[model samples]
Target: MTALVIIPTYDEAANLAWIVERVLAAQPQLHVLVADDGSPDGTGAIADALAAADDRVHVLHRVSKQGLGSAYRAGFAWGLERGYDTLLEMDADGSHRPEDLAQILAASATGADLVLGSRWVPGGGVVNWPWHRRLISRGGTLYARLLLGLDVKDATGGFRAFRRETLERLPLDQVASQGYCFQIDMTRRVAAAGMDVVEVPITFVERERGESKMSGAIVREALWRVTVWGAARLVPRRLRKGPRPEPESLASRPGA
Candidate 1:
């Protein structure tokens, strides 16, 4: 099956090429899409150079920094238009290893609609993360799980693969959440649709180069959005408002 991995970037010039090459080397059927959000550090130029050198590599240049969800939405549209069968999401940073990509893809090939590269699963773990970071991740996952009724171990993990059909079925126009919330929102939608979701163990390593995109604002956004959505579920059917508008903003991927 054909697969396209979309890597969202803001100022990831230091780690872009290294991660792209490794992703390309991971699987013969894999293609790379670098969704650059007008990084002034010449990340867009670097992506252009890579795309020029390798046919499998492509670049999508946005006017300015958009949210993580926006980049994936654009990338998914591009891949869907080009007839890609499987679409994957990964960080531009080195944290989401290219080596584990094979396992995610393998899981997708085995009839799973959505496959998450999970750290909380049995064979998975993280490296170089401080205790606070670990706590936030675990806590966030548990919170989303309980509120959203999700059964997966790592609902907030960004390293994931989606069958093209699954994306087509999802309400892409309504997915406005960013960063951690984006991951959780997508998981909630897939589960609500009764899709086959699989979690595969992956070793997540914190990025060695470039600054992390995690922020207090991102965490705060996730907490409130999840609480709002969860509360909506408990509302009396007759008095409930319509569906909440999906969140949209300029943000980046943290470990969560």
Candidate 2:
């Protein structure tokens, strides 16, 4: 099946080259689209250089850092237009392993609409995180699952694969959350759509370079947004379609 990996970046120059090389090596057939939010540190230029070196690598340059949701939305639109059968969202900071892409693709081929790289599962774990950071992540996922009535163990995970049909069906424009909540909200919507979603255990390694973009403000935004989404769902039929388009044919392109 054709696959396209969408990686969003702000100022990830330090890790971009290695991440891109590893992903390409892992699945030579997989095409990559880098959505860079005009980084002052030259991330966009770096991505362009990579794209120039490899035909399978593509780059989308945004004017500024408009948040992760917007970047992914743009990338998804680009991939959809090209007729990619499967779309993968991953961090450019190297937290997600390139080796796991094959597993996610395999899961999608097995009838799963969405496959998440889960860290809370039995075979998954976090590396290089402080105790407090671990607590925050665990607590956040647990709270989100309970409040949103989701069965997913890692709703906040950024690493995920989606079938082309699933992305097309999801209402991408309606996605409101920005950071981590955006991930949770999308996963919950997928489950609500009666699509099969699965979690594949993955090792989430902390970024070794580049400054973390996470902050109190981003976390607060997630909390607020998730609360609103959860509350709105209480009305049952009030939920609108997600920000993604309906499933489209994958025959238009060779890779996702």
Candidate 3:
């Protein structure tokens, strides 16, 4: 099964080259597509250089800064058009270990429709993060699980793999969340579609280079979006999910 890993970036030049090399080294057949949003720090130029050197490396340059949701949506559509059987998401920073890509793919091959590299699962942990940061991440995930009723442990995780069929069946065009909330958006969609989702242990490390995009705005977005989704689900189905798009799976919906 062919796989394509999508790495989204904005001013990630410091870590871009290193991350790309590590990803390619992890699996010889693994193809990488760097989706960059016109970073002023010459990140796009660096990506172009990498693509020029390696046939397996590709680049998608957006004219301006778009949210992670849109970047992944574009990358997914690109991979689907070219007929990749499996697609994956990884951050540009070093947080997502390239070595773990093997485990994620192995899980997918063993019949998992989606594989999440969860830091909260048994054998999973983080490196170099202080207590409060860990609390924020774990807390946010916990709050989301409580509100959304998702069975997954790390609902806010970004490291994930998906079979192409799963993405096609999901309402990709309708996803609106951008920040960390994008993870929750797709997680809910996967559960809503009743796909076989699995979680694997992965060590998430704090980025040694580049600034973290996580901020008050991003945190607020996750809180607000998750809260709104939870409240909407509490409403009667006749006024909510009943009128949505067609060909979309709703087997996991409430009272479906």
Candidate 4:
């Protein structure tokens, strides 16, 4: 399948080039698309240089720093219009390892509509993260799962791959999540659509450079939206179009 990796960036000059090169090296079929949000640190120029050097590399320069969701939406549109069969989303901050793309792609090839690189699955782990950060990640993931009736362990993970049909069918226009919550929103939608979803083990490394984009407001938006969505879906079993994943499955999940 024709594949593209969409990496959203904002002032990620230190990490972009290395990440793009490693991703390109990891899989020959995978193409890299860098969506730079007018990084003042010359990130856009670096992206342009890479694109000019390698035919596999592409760049998208937005006018300003839009939210992560918008950047991804724009990137998806770009890939879809160009007829890419598979699309992937990852962060430019080095938190997501490029090598894991192999396993993610393998899972996608197994007829799964969406493949999630999960830190909360067996063989998956995190490195160099503080206790509080760990707590927040684990807690936020559990919160999203419980609220949305999601069976997966890492709904909020940004390292994910989606089939073109799945992305095209998802209601992307309605997805307004700004932060990592976008991952959760998309995951929930994929499940709601009754699409095949798979989770694979991935080692998440905390970014050694660049600033984190997390904020209190983003967290609040996630919580608010998830609550509303969950409430609407909880009306009744017959009312919901798709079958909800059984909550009891959490007991068997590797890292649940």
Candidate 5:
């Protein structure tokens, strides 16, 4: 199956090249799309250089740091236009192992419409994380599960794979979360649409270079969005079951 992996970046110069190289080396046939948010550190230029050297690599240079949701939306559009069967998302930082790409793709092939690289599963765990960070991640995920009524083990995980059709069914522009919330919001949409979602165990390592993009703003955004969306689901069935547009048709629209 044709696969595309989207890596969103902002000021990730130190980790960009190695991550891309490792992904390409592991999955030779997989296409890599780097969606850079115009980093002041010249990450866009570095992505261009790599794309120049590799036919399977492509780059999307946004005007500025729009947000994680916007970058992934654009990347998904690009991948869909090329008729890719599977679309994957991951961090540019080495925290997400490139070795797991194959397993995620394999899971998708087996029947899962969405596959999450999970850290809370039996074989999965975190490395080099302090107690506070671990608590934040575990607590945040647990809170999301309770609030959203989702059975997912890692709702906030950025490492995931999607069947092209499943992403196509999602209301991409309506996805409002920009940080960790973005991941949770998308998973909620996937489950809401009755798609088969699965989680694969993976080791999540802390990044060696560059600072984390997570902040208080991200956490707050997630909390607010989930609360609002969850409440909306309580509306009458007639109001909620509105007709949705096709993915291809949506993509052709302006600013999709």
Candidate 6:
């Protein structure tokens, strides 16, 4: 199977190279796509350098710091057009371990349409996260699960794999949420499509370098979007309207 792991970056120069190298070392079938937003930190240049040295490494340079969802969407489009059968999402901050990638991919290979690396599962946990952060994550996930009737544990988790066919079946153009909500949105989409999703336990380690992209705005956005979606879900399908098309100006585009 040809797998492409998409690592989204913004001002992550400190952690990018190390994470990319680890991911590449994990499996020979895996290739790296560094989707870098125009990080003034010169992360794009670093990605260019890595791509120059290794054929397995590729780069997608965005013009500005678009959110996490935009980066992944762009990466997915690029990988799909290149005929990659398997696409994966990972973080450049090292929170998502490369060592666990094999098990996730193996799960996907076993007829699962999507594989989620979950910290709330039986064998999964987080290292170095303080109580409040953990509470926020757990609470947010629980809220989403209760409201959305989601069965999975880590709907907000970012480490995951997708079959190209599964992605092709989903309405990718409708996804506009970013950060944690982006993960939740995809989970909802996959569940709605009756796709087989497997959650593998994975230990999430807090980033050792660089500032986290997490912000009050991101958390607020997740809460607001989930509430709106959940409310919409309560309406009967016959009564509910199809999603409104977002303006083209809001769409994300990569840099030349």
Best by TM-score: 1
39: Cα error in model 4, Å: 1.3
User: Who is ahead in TM-score, 3 or 4?
Assistant: 3
Task: Point out the worst 10-residue segment of candidate 3 by lDDT.
Answer: 240-249
Q: What total of clashing residue pairs does each candidate reach?
A: 1, 16, 0, 0, 0, 0
Q: Where is the poorest 10-residue window by lDDT in model 6?
A: 247-256
What are the per-residue Cα lDDT tens digits for candidate 3 across 49-79? 9999999999999999998989999999999
Give RMSD to native, each candidate.
11.4, 12.5, 8.3, 11.4, 10.0, 10.4
Instruction: Supply candidate 2's per-residue lDDT for 124.
Output: 93
lDDT of 6 by residue, 134-225 (tens): 98899989989988988999999999999999999999998999998999999999998998889999999999999988899999999999
Pairs of residues clashing in candidate 5 = none
- In model 5, which runs have C-alpha deviations exceeding 4 angstroms? 234-256
TM-score of each: 0.93, 0.90, 0.91, 0.90, 0.90, 0.92
lDDT of 6 at 109: 88
- State the lDDT of candidate 2 residue by residue for 1-256, as single tens digits: 8899999999999999999999999999999999999999999999999999999999999998899988888999999999999999999989999988878888999989999999999999999988977877888888787677889888888999999899889999998678887888789889999999899999999999999888898788878877776777665553454456657778755685
lDDT score at residue 16, model 6, on the 0-100 scale: 87
lDDT of 1 by residue, 1-256 (tens): 8899999999999999999999888775689999999999999999999999999999999999988989999999999999999999999999999999989989999989999999999999999999998998999989988888889999889999999999999999999899788999999999999999999999999999999999998899899999998888767665686667667544643543
Specify the poorest-scoring 10-residue window by lDDT in model 2.
234-243
Q: Which stretches of candidate 1 lie over 4 Å from their true place?
A: 239-256
Backbone clash pairs for candidate 4 read: none
Least well predicted 10-residue stretch by lDDT in candidate 5: 229-238
* Runs in model 3 lying further than 4 Å from the true structure: 237-256
Which of 2 and 4 is the better model by lDDT?
A: 4
